[model samples]
Target: MASKNCCVMFMIFTVAIVQAVSYDTELFETAPCDSNACFDALHGALGDCSCNVDTIDYFNNVKIFPRIQSLVSKDYFRFYKVNLKKECPFWADDSRCAMKYCHIKTCSKDSVPGYVDEHENERPAEKYTKIDQTACSTDEDHNPDLGYLNMTISAASQYEIAKWNAHDSALENFCECDDRDADAEYVDLSLNPERYTGYKGPSAHRIWRSIYQENCFRPKLNPYESFPYVLSSDLSNMCLEKRVFYRAISGLHSSINIHLCSNYLLSEKGVDFAAPPEGEWGPNLEEFQRRFDPSQTHNEGPNWLKNLYFVYLLEMRALSKAGPYLETEEYFTGNPTEDEETRAAISNMLSVIYSFPDHFNESAMFNGGSQAAKLKNEFREHFWNISRIMDCVGCDKCKLWGKLQTQGLGTALKILFSSQWDSLEADPEQGTLPVRHKANKRLQRTEIVALFNAFARLSNSIRQLENFRIMLSANKEPEVKRNVFEGGGANIRSTKEQCSSGGDKPRIWS
Candidate 1:
């Protein structure tokens, strides 16, 4: 009995020591990199794309980021149309999230500006003219600046009336989701920001699991295995197209995790886990570490982070390619001043992106001998299916962002790989390809919004990563204590004790 007790104590002591070492290692791995070293680390050939991370970092921080922020906040880009009431096709369980944060507050039709009800007899152009006139006249201030703004806005509205194309039904081929459903409604994206909603556990995991298992074109390894394990396998042997698919999905996953960590609800002394309280929200370093630190994420953190950059470059390349199309599109929201500003911001963003010498070459993809066409089709189908899976997500907020980002990515793929690129006319003087007017190939307004917004999300994630690194390096992270229930939920223990004893499994959330 004495010997057995000694053996048990030794095992417990060993676990404690190992857990302590692991915690220390995680901290060390996440320590902030020197400025030069960090940029240098990001410099590499990601798949077919080669870019200087320093250049991307500088452009995004100084030039493009601010413009994207401004553009997304504009009237045209702020509203998103989605069918939140769609049932999950994969499973019968339609129990949506119960958490308050999980639900999105939708905008009423009356509150949405420039929204044209199909039941009304008035044409969109005429309605927009009325709204624009009202906006210009309502202001009490008759200053010269206000007059200039109104003039610019009116001009923009007139220009949009001449050029704007209604939502194209044929463009639905690029997106898998049914956006034309009568039940669909416009959501004010600014009001429903993507943040931590405490929607985690089996439901969240199942969604990602289905995505990776059914959608990603990976070799038949164990399909039931965890994502990190499957991702960390020998990906070097995979074909370029397959690799790109996997990396893009992983990049999106990393971005979602980053958003959650950046805007996590900090645990306080009087925090109640039973109900959703308006808790203090800020960066939670421990949550960041759990999702991203190499020591905790099966050594897949660095790879996932690198993939995030790859996706950014891929989407940026698509934007660069679609410059002519974007420039021609009108952003009319009935508010002329805001519409003009939106166009200017987009133009500035494009200029900055165009100045960058290194952009991903779409031609490098889908070149696998005789199987190239087949492979390309497979790639498109897989991404489309992934977009469809967004409907299965239990959280309304997560579903909203998921559908937008995925649709955006799908649009990028269409721009890159579709036959539409062949139709672009080259302008020798401009040194850019201007999109030829093809009725079936033009990008829809929703797609344009999704494309830029998705890029903005990825850019923000990269910035958040840097912020978290600084916080970790400065040792300014507050210790978050989680309550561990014990003895039939009567006794409470600290997360420290749970960590030391190896008594808790890692919590993976979306």
Candidate 2:
């Protein structure tokens, strides 16, 4: 009995330790750098890695995607075009780009006082090294980005440049040996101008007509026979679409880097908006105090409402761009003939799907019963395409790419059970106005019930991506692939069953 009790205690302790450990903790530990480090270290490494046009051309052909995906998400590579220009120091003529204006003053090592030896020969004496020597510099010819890029590229083992590699320590060298591939290039922008001269802003599509007329269409079939041949719009349009996708994806990702999305995930139980104190107007304290007495009206409603509203708008815009691409029959099913274009579109879609939840998790504040129902309808229509992609591309690895679409829908469903929708909409000053104003602004109870039902259906359709990743990682067998999609419904039901025990209460962001 004593031996049995000791064995039971040991077993319990082992299970407790195992349960306490995180699956991702080890995965991240082996990663070259954390997310935060990637921002600065990668920036610094790229600065060093940027060589002249020749080096740029060489790296453009190199394949790093296969290596990058082992640790980092492949979505990061889409920014390669912008990164090539922004991160790399480009000189049309690398030789002429000089920093000859810089002048330096140095102290001579022999200038230190010396001690006399027995043979009357002067012996050198030790002296402190003075690093404060002033150096004259002219800003007229200095390109700091180029200089830094050159210096980093000059280091060995840290980065790979044209005939140059950084020989720095692992910690100092962000670029590993596997990052280098001197062979064929994976990205080709040879036809499109390296830079888009048109209004390259968030709303790039608006200037598409102007861009096409000026830069895109003019190269081909010029009246003058002397003009060189130009590539058709086939590649150019893809590049433009990718640019829009990149900007859209970057905007959403920037929010994550800012730590605005630390709390929201599909697994989260509730989302509570940070309600600001009532009677306080943003940006005008004096006007707020004069217009409204603090004692009369209620203070502190949902503070995150305004931010969540903006996030919703941004999310909608991103989804609008990504949705059409994913919906296209050709893109959903792989194009065997035009594989590159299909792959690019698929990559963009993945970025879009991945970023949706990051922004959608904050969207609980803006959701109403009707909105939830519409989302549910969209999810049913779209889930098949998403699932098709997952089924074809290893469902365990790719399901999250599809399920990210319905996270907001699930949140909407959960929130409807205990909605403050009526209270929020009834307040005249709450600024619940839509883009277009209407006579009937409030949602009906039937719509709310429909929304709850919709969310329920959508929620049941997909399972947690993180769980799938863990399962797939643990079980390498091919049988698990089929089991994953089928098993998703079972897991969703189980999760719902657990949540039902808590009375399906709308959890507010705490």
Best by lDDT: 1
* TM-score of every candidate relative to the true structure: 0.73, 0.16
Residue ranges of candidate 1 with Cα displaced over 4 Å: 1-47, 117-174, 220-229, 267-277, 368-370, 424-432, 478-510
Error of 1 at 285 (Å): 1.0
Kindly list the per-residue Cα lDDT of model 2 for residues 1-510, writing each as its tens digit. Answer: 999999999999887655433211211112121111111111111111122222221221232122212212122121111111111111121111121111112222132112111122211111111232233354879865565422221233322331131322221111111112222112211121111011112122111211122222122242312111121222143222222222222221122111111111121122234422211111111111111121211111011111112232333322332232223323211225443454564455334334432222222333557865553333232212211221121111111211222232222322322222223222133222121222122222222222222222222211212222233344332221112221111010000000000001111111
Model 2 spans > 4 angstroms off:
1-79, 83-309, 329-510
Local lDDT at 318 for model 2: 28
Estimate, for each residue in 372-399, the C-alpha lDDT of model 1 and write its tens digit: 9777766766676667768878888888
